[model samples]
Target: MKDMVTPTMPVFEDMLAAHDRIAPHIHRTPVLTSAYLNGLSGAELFFKCENFQKAGAFKVRGACNAVFGLDNETARRGVATHSSGNHALSLSYAAGRRGIPCHVVMPRTAPQAKKDAVRGYGGLITECEPSTSSREAVFAEVQAATGAEFVHPYDDPRVIAGQGTCSRELIEQTGGLDAVIAPIGGGGMVSGCCLTLSRLGPGTLIFAAEPEQADDACRSLRAGRIIADDAPETVADGLKVPLKDNTWHFVSRHVTDILTASEQEIVEAMRLAWQRMKIVIEPSSAVALAAILKNPEIFRGKRVGVIVTGGNVDLDRLPWSAG
Candidate 1:
């Protein structure tokens, strides 16, 4: 396999540009507060509800930016990417808006709901084994065959800049936050938070949440280098991938800590949000909340921003339900 080229690190200006470019396509998703969750976590939690976003996830912000920023010639051939779910559907949604072909390389084992959503968004799917190697290999073939522009799920600078816009809105929604937390997979959202907050909310502490079963990001932070796991089993399907250089650049520098929650804790958080907060958030989004609940001392007494990354769930297979 050839080395993936690392795009230049995105700056605050790039995030601003991305926000302006994608605003027409994306909703300025609301920030909601839950008194029950606040009382439980002992912190003033503001949930930036990207779950209500277009394509049902925060990935749309990045996907739209990448898809729309393409030149006419490049876009004529359309776009291609490999994602477990959210990014795939998001890119498809964006491409559909532009009336372009969107090819997706998805894991054969990815949630059926996500796969269905991707197809519903008009993305052409080619299934691969649920591993980084298989995903990349399949995506390479798709890209070559179609001659489409490649839009990496989290690693690309365009995607990171687009994701950073979420924090920009969060800082604006809440006057000033003491801290902010979001789930980390390939670290796009966390890196984006770091990118935006490091410049705008310089005083705000940034944290990345992860599942203990897939704690590569936490381990990498402690080890002072990237430690990738090929395929880790966790309920937070969106967080299975490992960090790339571009995302690692921001995460390593600006994130204050990497926290983790167990699988049961993640499911509980997801259920708690649905029951108490009256919102539908996927397991990946719940990791931040679970970490806050698990380590109240870290968030207590602080006005914290919790990114509700996405709402997409496989209703037929709720994690808390018995098989």
Candidate 2:
């Protein structure tokens, strides 16, 4: 593993500013509870349903902040990013709301529904091979041609601040929580949770959930360094990326522990959420629930908040349909 530097993280005040800046644009998605889920896990579970958010994912909050934060000239130049799915659509949605051009570099293997959503939002899509290097290289060319501001999916300060608002709302709405758990892809949402809960909910423990197939964050947490996996495969497609410097900074310091669940567990958890909670959540969101189910002792008799990050599933290609 390479040495990692701790990047400057967003503060509670940044989250406050982000909440205000994007208040009019994004939804303050509801915090829902389920009797069956709580009973099964032996914990009081509060689900922050970001799946109901605009663009069907929590990525919109960050995208809106980054797009709206730009001044006139920069906004005119537009914004650009490389994302496999939700961020692409979210950035496009934000840029569309601002009436500015948005350029996105997306993996060719990304779900067609997500690609369609990006186009529906008027984002110019450039296809890249499903690898980090290919995406970065193509994005460089796109940025050079358009002079677009690079709004990284997880690493940027504004994006991190925007993501922090989710946890801020959870803290305020719930009064208090014993612990907060969120699925970690690039560690954006988890980092945001860390930022808010560390300062505001000081007594609350922060835990990160991940798929066993893409467990770099869990490994990184244990190894005490950043670990970048070179294109790990998982049904939770949104979570294939590794933690960047900005996200790693918060994850390293504040997250109490990282847990992972297998593909079977993720699918079962997704089914359970839809069956019991009467909500549609993508597989990535279920990782948080799966983690809790697989580790009953950790959350036993505690009030835990779980962040459901998205609901952008392709109806035709449902993971449970594998039967």
Candidate 3:
């Protein structure tokens, strides 16, 4: 088995570099506000609409950084990783732009919309069982066969630095914020928020939102150690992965709290965003809004930045319409 490379912790400077490197490949996603949501939650929320991002998700930021940063020889070999959805498609998008082959190992249970998007962007897929162990095992085989440079979904410094660019844009767009909240799956986006906010907006409180069913990150924060669940199930399919040491470094140090909401709450919030904000966001993206509504005291009267992470939902199987 090829050994996984340990990613170095990213510094604020690295984020700056990543921003410049990936500027051409990504969108400076807009920040939007809804008065009704503000009245309901008592927080002035600025939604960073990464759902409008290229490839339909924020994961492209990290994937672009990893793919573009590679040297010619390494780039020629292509790139590979395992993701539930967003990262897989994001990597494929980035690799396609670079004219390189992208291989991905995704859970068989991942949203079909995401799988289709991956293929649409020219990625070759290898399916695995919906568990971390199976993903790793299958990814190892794919990596060996393809000899692709593995760009781990969230547990990579290049990826984290790339994800940090979202918050950097948030801070610049908002002037400043009292707090920033984003869905935490493998802690990539949250860790990126931590990496950026700690330096650029030191006073900003960083919060991670998660599905109650897949709340290992929340539990890990409380335990003061990593707590991983291999095959946790949740409506926020994109957030089922566990946090790794690379992300845990920022999450453990800078995150003010980790919040969770029930499956029903996430569904309701997803529907509410579509109804009120008229924006299409996935269950994973809705987790942050659900957490804010469930715990209004933490966010009330404050200027909060909410990262609306993605819009890649299976329209035929909307969570709210499920029987």
Candidate lDDT scores, in order, read 0.92, 0.90, 0.93
lDDT (0-100) at residue 88 of candidate 2?
85
lDDT by residue for model 2 (1-323), tens: 01111145678898888889999889999999999998999999999999999999999998998889889998999998877588988999999999999998888897777778889989999999987678778988988899888888888778999999999999889999999999998989988888788888999999989999999999999999999898799999889989988898899999999999999999999999999999999999999999999999999999999999999888888888867
Cα RMSDs, all models: 1.7, 2.6, 1.8
Per-model TM-score versus the true fold: 0.95, 0.95, 0.95
Q: For model 1, what is the C-alpha lDDT against the true structure?
A: 0.92
- Superposing every Cα of model 3 onto the true structure, what RMSD results? 1.8
Clashes found in each candidate (C-alpha, N, C closer than 3 A): 0, 0, 0
Error of 3 at 94 (Å): 0.2
Residue 118 local lDDT, model 3: 87
Cα lDDT tens digits, model 3, 43-76, are 9999999999998999999999999999999999
Residues 157-207, model 1: lDDT tens digits: 889999999999999999989999999999999989998998899999999
The alpha-carbon deviation from the true structure for residue 63 of candidate 1, after best TM-score superposition, in angstroms, is: 0.6
State candidate 1's TM-score.
0.95
lDDT of 1 at 144: 82
Model 2 bad stretches (over 4 Å): 1-8, 129-133
